[model samples]
Target chain A: MNRHLLAALGLGLIAGPALAADGIGAGLLKSQCIGCHAIAKPENTSLDRLWERKGPDLYYAGSKFNKPWLEKWLQNPVRIRPAGELYARHVKGGTKEDVVDESGMAPHPKLPKADAEAVAEALMALVAPAELVSKGAFKGEKVSMAMGGMFFGKLRGCGACHMAKPGFGGASGAELYTAGERLQGDYIYSYIKNPQQFDPRIWMPTLNLAEPDLQRLTGYILQLGATEAK
Target chain B: MMTNSRQLASTFSLAGLALASCFMLPANAAAADEQYAKAARNYDTYCAQCHGINRNGRGINSRDMSVQPRDHTDAKGMGDIPENEILKVIKEGGLAVNKSVLMPAWGNVMSDTEIREMAAYLRHVCNCGSGK
Candidate 1:
């Protein structure tokens, strides 16, 4: 009788808090988020469905986003994509076009501190396929901003679309200026290596970079996040 | 698939309208408007960051870049470079024309027809070439 009672107590001690924490986070996500955000990758990936998307894909949040950043970012959500998700939809021009349209279409709603943590927990649970992320392994090489900047801008022409530093480069793509802080280095390497793998028919071109280019670029992006970007 | 098809159709229609304008007929006023509107849209998407939305070389990024992007609004400057040169520069990038390395080759992203349209649009903005 004593052994049975002890086993029950132990099971409650372990599973109680763990289940409660994860359950609350999952519950919050289901109620408040699934309306706009996708917790699961869609089965149909046609261009129409891509256009219909409201928020960036969070299905791979577990692998793509860092937990701490997710928590902090949720508390005060900000626009990351410069031209909004679908550039064609949000952009316009006129006599006085004021054309930058840097403040992407609609700002993401922010969450309170505690809610942010819970949502982050739920978000971080959304991991990508192991095969993809497993292929990525960041060496964390320390590359100088000058060298990486040259590779990104002059050689590869990335500066034409993406910002290397805040407000310093072009604005069509997501500014990886804060890449290290905002993402896992492995995810950055994997995504840069093959963006279309993540989202087929997306605008990011295939650079067909080899080993060093991939490593160097990933290292540089990580370094970019470590820089003074907010 | 559906949206891509729609965009492709829209592009073809706009191209046909642009072709009409090349002959100076413009088909109808609405079609001509659509062509220019698309030109403006493309410009806003690709070139405006460094070249300035006003096409006056005061783009938001201009303050930081060492080499200033060309002002499409400058008639004399745009006229000096032949329209063919503009097309080549846009398609092959500045390095091809011994211009600033900052200019990336849009050939990877934009269609040849789109690049041709962009060159013509530059002429329109500068009030040179057929725009005169």
Candidate 2:
């Protein structure tokens, strides 16, 4: 009996660490997120596979999301992409029915406070390579609304797809009116610099803007959040 | 199994003949209508968000924009505009024509054939060169 008890204790010791590492959050992620989100590391960066995905890849969620913002978003979900991930699939013939239904996207399920916190914790653990988040990608520089607005609307033509204000701008991408509040500056800078890194088949073309222009554009997006607060 | 295989072969032949007819046929009213329909569908996919389904310039995104989207149905305004200019705008965006920059360059996204088709649809809508 003593030998059996000792063997059981040894097995418990062996399994405890593994269970602790992959706790409730990991289980929840498997159950709730894997259906839509790509929680596992992507095996290939093929555009065809990227297009096949139902939702945005969250493999690099730790690098992409601000924890607090993610937590809040999980609790009270809202539509980000006006045309959904694949705009072609969402926006059909320019009809009243298509516009009203927003057929591309289904509403994200809202999580309870505890579940949201747990999910946020799990997501924050999902990190990409260090090279993806290089130093100086985001310097937290400030940009005035006038200068940023000019670049967004005229110089760069970002306004074509993204809205700087409600009901304004382009209708295909994530609404930029709330970007500053919604996104992290680092994620925004990195994403705009090279969207292919996050999503290979995304409709957003690489602008190939100069470094200064890139900084200015990121600053403009960050400033939009503060501007809306007023 | 042999009978079923024969049936499948006959079905495939029928489908192949139908497809071949579509290509060999001369331009007809139905073909023109199909082309127009395709162009209209393309416009809805790419342009209708800002340009509106009816080409009236009051799209879902129009209210939020600083400059209003151009009303394509405005025959007088569109009449003066050249076909080349319309094609240029579709290819290069409003910035190409010194118009609003809110229009994005679609050259990267659309093929030349698609752009031409869009221009044709635009002309059809405005009744340009139809002599009223």
Candidate 3:
């Protein structure tokens, strides 16, 4: 059994979208999205990497994107990336434009309204919420924050990449010591789980942490800006 | 007549041994060839991305990446990572072992057989083994 299969495996495998929706939405995603995005399978070749020119992977969209944002984006595509895809101009050498135009993103021509709703629901269902909550979804507590702070620097080594304050941590990844005050929890959670899923070809390590560890880490980091102390 | 029967039995046994060897030889060759091909392909698609086309950490994506992708061609660093550790990292993912979350787990993506093949390919490309 995988490490996720702990004895307290509440809700178990049925924890995902299968129990929430009739699956009509997931069925549509399978037809529409699977060509580019992978919910589970990994491979040397990915259609998203090839066809999109450059973009984020969507294997864990269920866990990464917020429900409302996902629904909105699906219905109306937006330009989230300022630089487009990083490797958009890799083949053409250093010359030529590199970014994908923001105006280029358009709504699916044939996605029915019903299917969109279903797809959104299905995708949202992909994340295991309870597991996230258990880890460290702290409503607010000084002790939790303090403990989280210590864990973040020494144990997890989050300081290695991120640019936290002088005593906070290092600068290997995004600055997240104060992520608690600035970014939303879901956004932080998704980014922490798989940075590249939101932004393709990102360099953050695909950390193999337990669900609880991830939630705790996310929770602790999210509270960084809210601590009210320097 | 007794001598003739004994000779016939011996010949049959020899023939059976020959047929078995014939089957085993081709099967062994084909299996080895298939693994080699898979290893080559896995290296081209997966390892080459971070390690560059030449098994060095100079791929296009490696430039802007926060942590400079490890130079697999660096004999010194490659020596530190054992084949078993590399296999574990590849299969379980970089973050699982508190290494880097950037390296995703291929367990969901590739099969065990594919992972084994990829492991063999890494050894072939790096050529570091237990030492640099």
Candidate 4:
């Protein structure tokens, strides 16, 4: 009956639904993501464990993916790896029949906007190791397209597996053209330096590139997103 | 030293035998066709992105690559290359043949038989003669 009591009750009513939504989000991730993705800390870091995974490791999703890209991808799933994560399983023969089978690989399940946002928010909380996130890991350096392109295509052979431009390059790995917009710069640097740290069974071989080349390659990946924007 | 009539008769017999051997060509052709089909499928699944769906080396991914993929349709460029070279490239990648390293070695993933079939397919695309 008192004014103060009435105000307190109204605040509680507003906060209750928000709290409930967060709970529902956590529940949704547990039910949906656990089946395929590694939502929790991975128990094994062996190559065998990588082969056994059905989907990419998302334990570092918060530090790996750009928030907007993660949210958008969840709402409308698209093929990032042209050949899927495990290329052998996803890509069959090269015939028309084979192409059809390749198309039939398990597509990422889509989520409603609210569910996607909730899931994205939850995923973003999953951070990487402190060392991986150490200051100056990326240094925000820039590289000329020519230099970056050279490192990708000639020096490092990255184009063999990843698409440097839309529709160009290898089909078995993730298209790198949009990587700048899709991934965190630090994650890209870290992953390129050593993909085994994230996924040991990843088909991509380590180039063991020199430090300067690595920096150039990372800079070029960021440039790819900018080029796409134009 | 034989008479004209006798010589004509022997020539006719030889012609008949040659015509009979032509019948075996179809069976051999069919086997080649099957191998080619498999190779085509393999190319589509693995190489089509950079090599182009039509195998012209103008795949969608080629646009951004610093080194363009070899155009299989280029009869002149691929014609002189031996099947073994093509196979080497497929299995060991471009660097193995002193080419660009942009091509990844598929040895770890594809079997020897598949690599051979791919070589045959490349020859077929280039319209190159079987490197004897």
Candidate 5:
């Protein structure tokens, strides 16, 4: 079966207010979720580039997801984007090449149920950027993210890891060349901080970068789907 | 005429029985020996230090290991894990891409061919299969 389908089976534990009550649940979050998703109130977008490249950002999850939907998804994830994860290759392309087996998505086998509930609560409260994205509204050709996209897709070789544009690359991992259309920036950041926790063995490597570089990388990645490509 | 016929029939039956036993006995003995020899060598090199000679989860390093190794003789636990997964673990090491860090990375230390052989040994020695 597809890795996404296998992952969906175990995502049921990530529901609303996962972190509000603290105690054992908080401990579970520390060991399990913090490895990937951020626990500190969102601040520097520094560590956002080093994540698993699969799954969306949970940084401002409160704003982007409906409480009910978040709860439902935490308990049973669905295929929001049929393509695969967002950052599998850590590049503009989000390649489909290296996406490995998905049977690894078993619930934190050692985590307790009460803690799982508390983690859900904490996550449900996450809402970083409350602003709406103004993409297709037409900011016009005055500013061309195309140069950035080109640097991202070819010059920097982000396409080698992520999905390639049109026909240039293979699908060893996730699909990203068009992420501007799908993902939020905060979520992108979260994926970068810790990838293994999201899905133990993502195709990407752990580059161990500092915060500022992380933000600059995020800026580049989030521009994947810029409306006004030059 | 009756006595001659009886002796000939008796001789034929005895020879046929002896030939059949000779063919069957060696095949069975060789199969058992081959399986045992393979597992014995595997246990000595890869497992005996950690699992002990008895397969009782008490190797020399067992005391130092934080997460105690799984008892291979546990029919229930071994059944849950598939053979291929075990083979993968053995080849890649416990900490390789898919398993725990405590298990250590075996890819650099052991060949893929060796890993498969070790897995077969586990199946033969522990009788651990996917089925409970």
Candidate 6:
């Protein structure tokens, strides 16, 4: 009878924190995140509606972000994109140059460690479509920076939008230096395959990249982001 | 003896012309080469991404873009485009001429003088004189 009592006590102790953590996460999502973030997958992908978004869509956070990075980032959030979410809206100055208006972009709210972890837990549950992310899009193919830059910079002109490094590339899109650590390899491949499927009104064109080139570009971007994360 | 003197004068004149050409030819050729080199450098930096390094509209970005970048090497196509039209495209971007907005305007980045130089450079690349 004593042994049975002790076993029940042990099981309760082990499961208590786990269950409480999930409950806490759910509560936080309701109170803190829903205001600016879209916890549920948004059906509207129109540019006009997209312009109204304050923060990045988190419906695919599970597929898109690394849990560790997301948790860490939530604790001390910083600017990710140089141009911010919508470059067109945030830009100022003369029409000829169109410089980024730093004043227009608001910083993300910081969270405490416990809250960050709980929030990350809630976010990580939001996975993108299975067919796109589950498929073996990226097979961990090795790509050299030199070769990747040939396709990305010299050939594709990605430098005109996304920055490869600080002050090196264009600011129309998000910086790619931290992509490796922040994003999953599969998500990168899937996003590149067809950005329109996820974001219909995005300025980014679908390259319809084939094998080897697709894998190579994914590997290159991952390598680039990894280098910066370190 | 008189015929020999006249022949000598003709030979000396021909020799002088050849010597003068030797000095002048390289100088002219060097200047022309320098202009072409500068034009190529500019084109590579700004236009090569969509227009291609070969100037053939087969740039790396060409795969995904719906509208094809204008091919600079096609004499027929380039010949139809006037010098002013080329200048407008460079200074105001493709949208200025009812073309693709994908082509960013270089007016802020490049000066009016630079835009004119680019037009001349395009002409050189096409090997076609100004359409007008």
Tell me the tens digit of each residue's lDDT in model 1 across A61-176. 88988899989988888877666765545544534332455445767778899888888888887888976675458787898889998898878777765778776665557878
Q: How would you encode candidate 5's per-residue C-alpha lDDT over A190-228 as one tens digit per residue? A: 555444334333334333335654454556655644542
lDDT of 4 by residue, B4-81 (tens): 879998899999888877877887788778868766766765676567666777664565567888888898888888
Q: Which CAPRI category fits model 6?
A: incorrect
Query: What DockQ, on C-alphas, does every prediction get?
Result: 0.12, 0.17, 0.04, 0.10, 0.01, 0.01
| Docking class for candidate 4 | incorrect
Number of the top-ranking candidate, with DockQ as the measure? 2
Evaluated against the true structure, the overall lDDT of model 1 is 0.75
lDDT of 2 by residue, A140-167 (tens): 8889889999998877878867878776
Clashing pairs in 6: A155-B60
- Model 1 alpha-carbon miss at residue B88, Å: 4.0
Candidate 3 lDDT by residue in tens digits, A1-230? 65556733655555643555448877877777776566543564443354343334455556555566566556765433222333222222122212123354443334556766788788765653444322234333333776776666555655544544533222223445444433456656655676545434343545656666667777776566555324
lDDT of 6 by residue, A1-230 (tens): 99999999999998886565467776898798888878777777654566688877787888989999989999999888776776555654433233567888888889999999988987887778887576577899788888998788756556656777776665656788888888889888888777766766555556556877778888999999877557
Which residue segments of model 5 deviate by more than 4 Å?
A: A1-147, A154-156, A164-170, A197-200, A208-213, A228-230, B1-132
C-alpha lDDT score of every prediction, in listed order = 0.75, 0.75, 0.56, 0.74, 0.49, 0.75
Per-residue lDDT of model 3, residues B33-66, tens digit only: 6768856655544454445555566543444444
Indicate the residue-level lDDT of B39 in model 2: 75
Error of 4 at B15 (Å): 40
Instruction: Report iRMS values in order.
Output: 4.7, 4.4, 8.9, 6.4, 19.2, 12.6
* Candidates 5 and 6 compared by TM-score, better number: 6
